[model samples]
Target: MANIEQRGENSYRFTVYLPKDAKGRYPKERMTYTVEGKYTPKQLQEHLDHEYLKFKAEVLSGNYVRPEAMTFSTFIKEWDKKYASKLAKTTHGNHVRKLDLHILPEIGHMEMSQINEFILMKLLDGLQRKDGQDGELSFHSKRDVYRTLKSIFKYAVKWKVLSQNPMDGVEKPKAKDTEEEYQDLQVYDEDEIAQLMEIIQNELPHWRAMFTLALAAGMRRGELLGLQWNDIDFDNNQITIHTTIVLTKGGPHIKRTKTRSSKRTVTLPLSMMEELRTYQKHHKNTREDSGERWIETEYDWVFCQFNGEHMYPSSPSNRWAKMLQKHNFRYIRLHDLRHTSASLLIAQGIHAKIISERLGHSDISVTMNTYGHAFKSADRAAAEKMESIFLKK
Candidate 1:
């Protein structure tokens, strides 16, 4: 038997009766569910009715189990080994970390079948509240946690553990203003770049060539570190980027570029190429002096330690930060150099398509979306120039 009772605004209780006991006498206790949301009265009744029908069908089919029968904590641990194992190492690590740190502490004890849309909404809203370990998380972080839960529920559906995914009704959070603020703070200007370059030339002679290549080609930090002497074409003045250095928990690992577009051939400026050649000569002399002490890999990396070992992926960023600090320059992360390259190109009337290719973005839309503000500024400047040329007295 199913009966729906209103329990204030946007809330209702669904009372479901169980089968008779051994002596054909009904049990005193029944299941009552309190559902809450933004639903109107009619919508709330409709939802309760639907859930009642589904529960009756499951019971009639001999498949109904009480909500308290299965816990989420038990299922998620099993899900990790079987499903999470199929994911990439880094991705799998992220999933486990989130599950352990943020998710499990909140909902792990609840049964999967008992978790409804209302519960999911409350959990997400709680995450947005400024009461967690690091205060209120960003929309993106909350969204990621939501996504992980969604994926877990999807798995539950696939395994026939639940008939519906509660997250299907939840709205994913939108981009907040902090994203724009962070992106704008992640780049440098022409004057700052010139000053940094001069300091790099004077003080950090060994890393000067790599830093120059970073600003000039917009190559990623990993790509720059993975470069080998053979990847460079001195005659053609182009460098092929097919590999990258990735740092994981274990150690530094050599892997392919982030995406297909990331594995590109970028033409080097003549002066930059000459500087690289000069650096190559100096590196060769140093290697010869080191003799048997040089630990050479198969590729003979262009950038490495004094003993010719692979450089850690984080070293470049750390070194760049230290150099700026020592010279009393404005602090910008090493990756900001890539943004600087894009900003400089956008300011010089270069087409977005060409800049996208130079930056090795998988899609031009990514490049456009990232640099839209810069493009807007450039567009305004272009319009002013046209007015000066044709409308001036």
Candidate 2:
């Protein structure tokens, strides 16, 4: 299966001839593998013989694949350059961390053709969030790893490196108790939202405008922080979301919407638009007052700092939490404001599809899944209306 040849006094080369490929195509240029190393005369023959046997075993087992392509690490360079570049910066950054920190270090050296279900499962099972937690990994972290692996294996199949995706054999990861996660979903009910609407009016002009628009438009945190003045259409009372700001260790980063659907236009209530106009006047005065000191960002951010810099991504959440605490209000995470907006629409019997479009959800199923409680309430009201009509007949 192999032979050893002397290249120098202490260096020798071992070449192992690989077997025929799938279609029985028996011989190609890159199918053979050669390893050259300097070895002592006493150990040279035995070392080359062992390496030849090992190489032949890999070829027989269908693990070596096309030797030129070689390891999973080698395939990733191609995937990163060609495919991963298309992914959103936040998503691509996340994938890079999962691959480099976890997956690649473990199996990057293994031939792409050699990866199997057992190997993948073991890697996922061993995953743990290195942050403040016990050894048990969070379901979310493990799920990300599973998603990353599945995408890689799927591409491996498409790129003809592997015959099938090994992830097909692996069960999808799930939370141990999904109900516990659902129970943690805190949203302000209609009454609480109403009270906040009134309270924010008296609090401050800047915060009032921000909080009102958040509840009205149901924009994500980053989307709100990244909102630019040009994105607004005063004539139509609408705003487009095509860019987002994500805080990074280096600083804030402007990224495109994660998916096509995430780039959307949301129609605001007329009253909210009116309030925004008023805020714009106030903002202009503030900017002029800071004339010499005002900083400018790439976009004319609608929710800029007093000095006209882009608002920090986490600023709203932290400030919201403090405001709730100070006022002794029932607390919910800032994200739950989005859920509160959806709930208000559901209460008014807005169609789920319309709500999904307004919220810029990638799929209607995501809207249904996250706000099933609101859907249930809407459904109950529909049933009662049907009952009243039938009873009257």
Candidate 3:
């Protein structure tokens, strides 16, 4: 069924009929291969016939890797559209960024068969910094890159595009202790929180309400910003966290909470509730002063600009920095407020499960792992209490 056409001197093209289809057609999956060598027409045809027979055998066995199969670039494009489209936007964005910045630049042109553990290790080595070598990517970033690569390969294997994944036993790059330690210290002490609260109360009562809610409810900045008046239950002394204001590339977007657990209701302190009521009244007055200039979004956000437009996602963080500098207080990221709330609750002997619920963590283990150091002191206190009780007995 295959035809070998001689084009010029020492050049010929071979066309072949593939294996049987569901309709029993041999040419259903046709293939064309070029055979150019220093052989005569008869010799070239014989060689092409042998190659065609081998190709047919492999195709029948589902082991055929066509010469015109996907390149890394084409495969990745398909991956993004078909598979990665289901991922969260932020996660998908990170994957695309890593592929563009790290992975694709090196092995993008290679065929699927060309990819192996050795080639992947070489790619990892290219990302790593060694003696007399300067690489901008960190070990943690390289680990992320490796994981992304593994995910891509895993998808390829699932679709039978690749025979096997090369990242099965690949070693991950390790991050330095300094980076880990820095992550551990990303929280503020109770005294620092108290100091910040005192300063904000005296100078900016409106902001005081915001900070108090953040500390008392253990809500993330985005969750706080996304809050609407109706989401708060002053009667029940609770606030429902159903959504968050995520900072997207386009602008601030109101999206569902990161997880199902993040949609739970958290109780607020009576004092914090009073502060919110007062702030609401003041905000209403301010809006009245703005009059026609006040813009209304369908969300009816609790926290917004004077014109009632939704506040930018970064506004809280920006205000946090300036407020700390203005009050001459020690600096902490705005996110540390939530950590501070968890730490204070731990110090007060609150159960880990309770704190985890307040913080809307998907699992109690997540709360324990993140604030494990806070629990160490609580553990010591528990031991001392047990000892005292036994002595009294």
Which candidate leads the pack in TM-score?
1
Which residue window of length 10 is worst by lDDT in model 2?
A: 27-36
366, model 3: CA deviation in Å?
Answer: 2.0
Deviation in Å, model 2, residue 284 alpha carbon: 0.9
Please write out the lDDT profile of model 1 over residues 278-348, one tens digit for every residue.
99999899899998898775768888888898798899998888988888988887888999899999999
Which stretches of model 3 miss by more than 4 angstroms?
Answer: 1-73, 100-147, 171-185, 202-206, 384-393
lDDT (Cα atoms) of all candidates against the true structure: 0.79, 0.79, 0.78
List of clashing residue pairs for candidate 2: none
Residues 1-393 of candidate 2: C-alpha lDDT, one tens digit per residue: 336666555444445555587878665222222334676757866776786677667666766546335698988876888687677667777888888778898999988768889998888888765666657566667778888888887877765567788999998777678554455456787778788887787756777888888889998889888888889899999999998898754567888877888999999999999999999999888888998788795568888887788888888888888888888898888888888888889989999999998888999999998888778878999999999999998
Clashes of each: 0, 0, 0
Q: Rate residue 393 of model 1 by lDDT.
A: 69
Ranking by TM-score: 1, 3, 2
RMSD of 3: 11.5
Q: lDDT tens string, model 3, 152-267?
A: 98888765576678888677866466445236346667677667777888756556777788888888998988888999898988899997887754567778998998998998
Better by lDDT, candidate 3 or 2: 2
Report how far residue 268 has shifted in candidate 3, in Å. 1.4
The number of clashing residue pairs in model 1 is 0
Alpha-carbon RMSD of each model: 10.7, 11.1, 11.5
Candidate with the larger TM-score of 2 and 3: 3
